[model samples]
Target: MELLQPGESQATRLHTPKGDVEGVVTCVTPWHFRISVPEDKAALAATWLRDLSDGYVAFDPDPLRRLPGPIVVSDSEAQPVTQATGVPESHLKPYYIGIGSTTDLEPLPAFTWEEREPEQLRRTPLFETHRQMGAKMIPFAGWEMPVWYTSVTEEHLATRQAAGLFDVAHMGVYQAEGPDAGVFLDSVCGNDISALAVGESCYTHFLDPDANVIDDTIVYRRDQDKYLIVVNAANDDKDWAWLNAVRDGKVRIDSQRPWARAFGRRVILRNLRDPKEGPDMRVDIALQGPKSRDILLALGCDAETRKRVLALKRTELCEATIGGFDLVVSRTGYTGEKMAFELFVHPERAVDLWNALLKVGEPMGLKPCGLGARDSLRTEAGLPLYGHELAGPFNLGVGEAGFGSFVKTYKPWFIGREAFLAREKQRQTVVVRFRFTEKGVRMAHLGDPVLDRKGRTIGFVTSCAIDSEGFLTGQAWVDLKYAEEGTPLYIFQGKPQSLGKSPAELKTGDRLLLPTPAVVLSRFPR
Candidate 1:
């Protein structure tokens, strides 16, 4: 084989099952090289690359002089190669080309030429209020949000027993409006957007073409031509980009699920959290628990608005002025409470609304909650979190997360519909909620392995938390055969610090680090 230096320009022909295809080498490294193909031949080149296993490519520095032996290339590490090759960055577009076997290559230690300064954490509109209340703040999804005021357990039980107020302004709020709004949403979301009447909302997921969940969201139909989408804080920017890509016709949908007629120009999306969008900008605050209705009633609102709030049901919303603030009130929340409500208000009014709710509801056992309690409550409620149950290293979809009912498979066409259906037909694993039957065990963590009776690894824990009942409650993705309710399992908790030496070094360390006994339940005992 001939050796080529970095940035060496050479005409190359790749031999594949299809035929020999020509391209120009744009960049080269010790392990990989990128090829630039003509735009018209892009599809043919892709097909050639996909068909090759152990292929050969001939390089000709000059048309008259070809290399003595063709370079043997094997497809490995399909991910983009970011290693620093001596070659200067090229302006020409390049296609993915894998070369040489990487099986024997040792993994490179992570290093960076320049240290990047840490990004400053963001603060919500009610940051000052939380500080004044002596809440313990921590970094969460790029925001310095409160984790708890008094204690996580205290705030958690308060929400379940009476009421708890939460500052959820960091969540992403978006609006889609125009003639084909519902049609466009129906094409992108897994749920049946057309089924939602004005003033109704439903939980759904944004799925990629492979059926992996992009993020789970709540879509509220605020008007005939407008809808509100609430997404997770960590996925706000990604969700925004994905929505725009669909709107601009940049993303491809399956032929079976064709795009809506005039989808590109018929709908307009707005980031409701953008202050530049004017006074209409919105953020979220939640009032959840059994006494949420009584606290909302005690607020200073007109008799008509109070009656409307009282009449609201789960998954229903209404535009109302409460406590002299104009906002949209929704009977929805992450916590599993029948009387919970999430209020969407302008950023300037968030602090006032929070204070107002506290003043009126504090007498009714309403406690200011934070992210810690929020997570614990959701875990106990068997709700799915984005990076945990829905999608992560496991690439779990709605079906695996036990929320497949929310996905309207009956719809003839939607993004990922075909792939999701195929996945469900072949699925062998499922996520199940479980609780530790005993106490004094370390909290289960993400990626902790789950084991069966004979010590066979079955699955891994997705999310876990200490619930209001002081028991460790968690969700795990286990093999389908082991997902039956009341199934016995064990969570392999890693070695505690007291065990001292590494398990490989200590004679008894492996025996000392024991798996916590757990039982799969139909759901957390709500």
Candidate 2:
């Protein structure tokens, strides 16, 4: 008998003692050949092959019909498993047969993730830190990132009840300066930058020529003529490319590569920039929760700074030393709780500052968290993530524009002005919500189907999750027609069983189910 080539299909007819039987010699090895037979004839095939080969052939012997063929089972009863060594395969692993109950089928092309070419994506400075922290890293926005440090539910609860820190250093930071800083921003961003005075910050989105969102970012007005924008990491290059492509006369943009790392201790982003040169910046630390202000007070911040923090207003940048190191204090945070602050610090002093915050805040329920907790907290608070909720340059109409009443009126005209203003007048608006059902509760993820009362799909989900209490929740940007408070909808999770089979579905209330059982507040909405 001839051995089968790696990719070749082969068939064989076996002659047995009891009867003459036909079987496909589907797999071949140096020592033996593997064969497949009809389900009803599986036992007969196994007995015949084993008896004929004696000690020469070896393969999995199961009562079931489907078996991976060409296995060199002579050495042992076990099949020649490629993954026995616990190492991922360097090449495409051979497909093994699985137990089947077949229905109407269609032939299709085959593909694998291993066959795709590598992409040149930038890595964050904190990449190694994430690995050391035991993060379950996954690919996100073209970067390998931690999907969760521990359990998503555990991390989510940690943030809601107390304070959790995140490593968001992967985000993109750009400095826009020159005489045309405002002019350039006006042309590229959707919000008005002309009104961005120094020491002020606002969240805004950039739009493409087609009026789709390019990226949602926070523009920090460092000076009358200088601005800083924090963009999504995956779209950093795209945003730069778009900026360079559309850059008009006089506006200069600088992309901050090798991203500078800073840590937040007491106050974040205080005294973070050089007045004469460098980016006028601050290292931001979010202090959240009812005891957030008390934590600052315990750190020795002045009364004025404490007062500003209490009011959630602009606090005078003051020096409050913690852990024997000083930090520029600014009251800000992402959690919706009463006391939160974004502390600024000198970049060189970031590590010392962060260590200090952890040291002092630990006694008060502050935990050093990774991106996973940060994401869950934000999602629970109904905030939008970059790629999941607002992938720009494509889906701009479904963003925060309709809800940007706070920042829109304050700026000079920015990019997407014409299209946004036009679309905003007649856009479908909806608030995303979490739905837990009696059937299995599945967290809504990106691309999950959003259905209306009649089960007609009207939109798709951007995010979803099962919180600490085991309640499933996710958000979706749907048609305004189905966006009303208390609107009933279903979320479909799995693929349909067949061409005519229905996908998995769950029903949920569209309105805000605040104080819902199993819900926690760990983050302030961005």
Candidate 3:
């Protein structure tokens, strides 16, 4: 038997009472294998199961099927096993599996995760800190991140009632500068960049030629010739590639990307995350809640900076010094809360700044939150998540969003201008707001059918959750004919079934649409 790594191959032979057999590792995840054994050697591989350990066990490839020949039973245990280990395979220490035979339908899956241990995942600067704080780190966008600190419900309420701090360093923060900064941004981004004066930020989208969103981002105008574009972490690479393609095609700038990629002769771009190698070495942090402003105030800013921060309006960014360290602060957030801000600081001082905020804001009931809380908070506010509610290079008519309010047809030119206009004229669908009418109805999920009174599907749920603010809440994209305010609909719930031994045996019943009133879907339902 061979203990094969994912995408790698190996072969080994097993020696037993009857004789010896050869096996090859076929797959790693489900522990698939192909073996060749003489009739006499088959039983020897099956009965060698005394030292059954965790990742080290004997393989019984066909446990449930009638065995080629298996007449060996030990009184110790009768449970069938899947993972095979021991003997001649000991030489392959780090990853070793011995050849074996027998009948077992479902073996415990232990080796799959062994191949993907925690150390194998990418770690952020705060990886150790998160583990110390008891944060349950999970894989997100290729980074090991804390999905929740304590509880999503608790963290959500903390941010709503008091304050919650979030590590947003994983976002893609790019800086574009030089004489053609505004021109480059205006031409590639969907929003009107000329209107973005210094010290201000705006919600915008990077659109493809077809006007569909490459990513929803916040563009901050640092100066007339400089801007900082913050994009979702998951789309960092795609956004970088798209930006280079867009700028290179323009052939007007020649800035460096390693320092910050060059789009033309004067324009240069650099990533904030790579501060050591780039211009900005700032870690992103989000402080949000009803008391968020108070916490920022308590960060020990000077009177002048305090006054400036107090005077700033929403979507505004300003430079300020806190505890003698300079920070870039933005009065914007995703949770739909009034007192929220996104702050950036030097990586060397992130832990200090984080500690300062928690210490200063502890009296105000501030808590360090995780992505789970951030998601729930955003969902409660009826915001659209990239993959779930908004994705692809969408036209004006796509999805359940009408961010066309941010689109500028009056601008000189930009990506997707013509395509967006054409799609706008051919608009055929609309997104709507909805809540379950019947008590005890479960929250809807993506692709769950949305039916009308006659039980015909007119749309499907885009985002749904049994929210803390209210009961079953969700969003759906509907046919223009059925996309009206106060329109009633139903969300189908799929039937349940047991886990299966193989892919073909997995049974899942179709969702049954229940007559529950779900309505109010005009983008912003009100």
* Top lDDT model: 1
- Candidate 1, 1-526: lDDT as tens digits: 0134566655665544455566666446533576665555557676555433223332222222112112344433333323323342221111112222223222222111232333898899999999999999999877899999998899999999999999999999999987568867877898988789899999999887678788899999999889999999888878888888776655544433232222323578999999887987999999999999899878878888888888888999999988788989999999988889999999999999999999999999999999999999999999999989988889888999998889887554567876888999999899999988897778888898899988899999999888877999899999999988999999886523453456668674344556889999885454
Estimated TM-score for each candidate: 0.74, 0.59, 0.69
* lDDT agreement with native, every candidate: 0.78, 0.50, 0.66
How far does residue 244 in candidate 3 sit from its true spot (Å)?
A: 1.4
| Error of model 2, residue 477, in angstroms | 2.7
True-structure RMSD, every candidate: 16.1, 27.6, 25.3
The per-residue C-alpha lDDT of model 2 at residue 458 equals: 72
lDDT of 3 by residue, 1-526 (tens): 2224445544546554445565433433323333433345445544453332221433433221111122232332222233333424332111113322232222221111011333456666677778899998888876788888888878888999999999887788888887667767876766777777799998888766566667788899887677888888777777876776555543211111111122232457767778454436766889999999999888787789999899879999888887776888899888778789998887777777888898989898999989888887776677777776676223223333656777776553466665666777777776666777755776567767778889787877777765566566777777777766778887675422432245554457634324567776445423
Best by TM-score: 1
Model 2 accuracy (lDDT, Cα): 0.50
lDDT of 3 at 506: 44
Task: Name the 10 consecutive residues with the lowest summed lDDT in model 1.
Answer: 89-98
How does residue 483 of candidate 2 score in lDDT? 55
Clashes, model 1: 0
**Candidates sorted by lDDT, best first:** 1, 3, 2
